[model samples]
Target: MDQYAQLLAALTEAGALGEEWRGAFERAPRSAFVPDGIWVEDSDAPSGYRLLSKAVDPVGWWAEVDSGRQVVTQLDDGRTDGPGVATSSGSMPSLVASMLRHLDATDGSTVLDIGTGTGWTAALLCRRLGDGAVTTVEVDPAVAAAAGVRLAELGLEPHRVVGDGLLGHPAGGPYDRIHSTAAVQRVPLPWIEQTRPGGVIVTPWGTPYANAGLLRLEVGERGRQSHGRFVGDVSFMWMRAQRPHAVTAPDRPPDHRGPSPLDPDLAEENVHAAFAIGLRVPGVRTLHTWQAADPSGTHRFRLSDDAGSWASVRFHDWDGADAVHQSGPRRLWDEVVAARRAWLEDGRPELTRFGLTVTATGDQHLWLDDPGNALS
Candidate 1:
């Protein structure tokens, strides 16, 4: 089989791509959407990414494009000589297919595609539902223009808009389906307003502590409210506006020091526990690291709010109890311990069992099992 066909077959076997989206995937090959210059992760590189040019290394470029991994298209929001943080990427093919499948769009379904990225997603939507049925919005003008060019190359022209996706392009709505490639801390009210009543909105929703959950919300009658569950796990670039502020350690020494009541590793190692804790504890970021010079082989787990609060726990090989240090107004370590206790008391539910409800006014309530059982 050809490379594209092989990919399709693999995705089909993996259950990421369904037969319904096969034609669309076939029509819009990922290679056509990928740029000539892309960044790949490198451990030794100072900025953690090494740029590869198609002109200089066509074979390597093709390999990366064809691979299952996401292709980083822009770094530091298009800053050439800036720190190599990946700001935009062509999402992993399996993830793209899986999200499209969950979208469950049908013939004549009008879609508002948020975060155009490489335009590959818009192309796929256009192929499935026709060009007129797709309207894609991108925050970055340069990214939008480049994606538009790629879409044109594929003979696909979805109404392209250059603006913040949070304020969705209302002119294209009330759309039947709203799909966002970017992750959001909270579902935008504009998205809810633009989607027709009974329509669906599929996007990655998560907290600052853990950014992994594919949320699928079904709009309520009259478009006043929506309810949905985290159908799957997905990690996507945060919507530029909603991206969490950098988590920096407080300059001063820690104020409180004691033995941790709970193992810090539990919060870092368990995904469900992490998700649950993130829901209960707001505005906290978790980090795990080890001291290179520590002779005792200590593992450090740190928590920060990017405000003035910070916490650190050190786990040594011979530990009676891990040492905990907290500073600032918020006792982050204590909050995490309490959140984890709550999760366990609630029967340690998986992330998928949790769901979200949002009203027209953007009041969000997270619940367990049913919408009525709202989390405090």
Candidate 2:
């Protein structure tokens, strides 16, 4: 076996790729998909990889691999430049295996792969489950075509489609598994619809400022649902179709005082939950959170177009729950108070204990634990 090939086996045995899916890891050549001139950043060394000027520089290109290093294959902002934007990449082998471990892909199982960047993952699915059983889609038509050709070059032929993955590829319906490489603020209904009743759909979902944690959910019949904890924190671009819907934060700084609205102290205690709740509310999109570290006094604002309102919510946790100031239309501070009251009355639950149930056709429903209560 080649040197990198041996390293792949080692990583798999070590549990990075899981023992079950090691077959896929063995056949795929990481070097084949990595262009010769691609820039790589190796923080382990004093400097990054020198820019490769050729595609077929056979010397040392097949060296062994390591883990947890962020490789910047594409630069100059991926939007404008097509060649190096990291439009396609061999994902960190460990992460690939981690998710695959959750998926537990089996022979003959069909998979709908969201975000077929570079077609490396599609190739993995083809290797494990057979090429015809894997259907991959990329919103970028150009990227999809290039990935298809690359996979073909590897002697694999999987169905590659160019369309909004949020809608999924209907032609490849009733898949046994569905995997998305991107993060989403809201889970799309089509994904639930496309998956087999018990099939799994995994993606990252969380606040816009921080990386989204992985959410693995199973679809139930009649729009009923059951899902558990989110996995490790990871970041990825949002899906194209779901871009229109985003969570926009309130404009006020994280801390501030406005005497006229509501109790400030309570607002301060529940401020974070309020912001997370807004994303679940209808008509809310494009959120930006700005917090004031100042303990003295500063009015925190939650601004957004969905509510068509701008308001300040202020409070100090140490001072008291009653110390509040509200200045805005529709009592924005009061709304935060409502969310807090709801949490308190129900025994202030943390995020991990929370469960999400997506039943709506156009929107998703987030419920707490086994109950049917709606969460933003």
**What is the lDDT of every predicted structure here?**
0.89, 0.60
Write one digit per residue (lDDT tens) for candidate 2, span 1-376: 7566666777866867765677787676555555455555555533433343344543534342233333334443245433333333456666776777777668878899998876777888888889899999888766677677778789998888888888888888888888987667777777877888878887766643233456777777755664545655455655655543334444554343435334544433442344344433333332323356854454343433345444444433423443443333444445555656666665765554455666546445566666455564
Model 1, residue pairs in steric clash: none
Number of colliding residue pairs in each model: 0, 29
Candidate 1's residue-wise lDDT over 215-297, tens digit each?
99999877367999998888999999999877675699989888887766777666788889999988898776676887346
What 10-residue stretch in candidate 2 is worst by lDDT? 279-288
- The number of the candidate with the highest TM-score is 1
Q: Give the candidate number with the greatest lDDT.
A: 1
Please report how far candidate 2 places residue 6 from its true position, in Å.
Answer: 7.4
Error of 1 at 64 (Å): 1.2
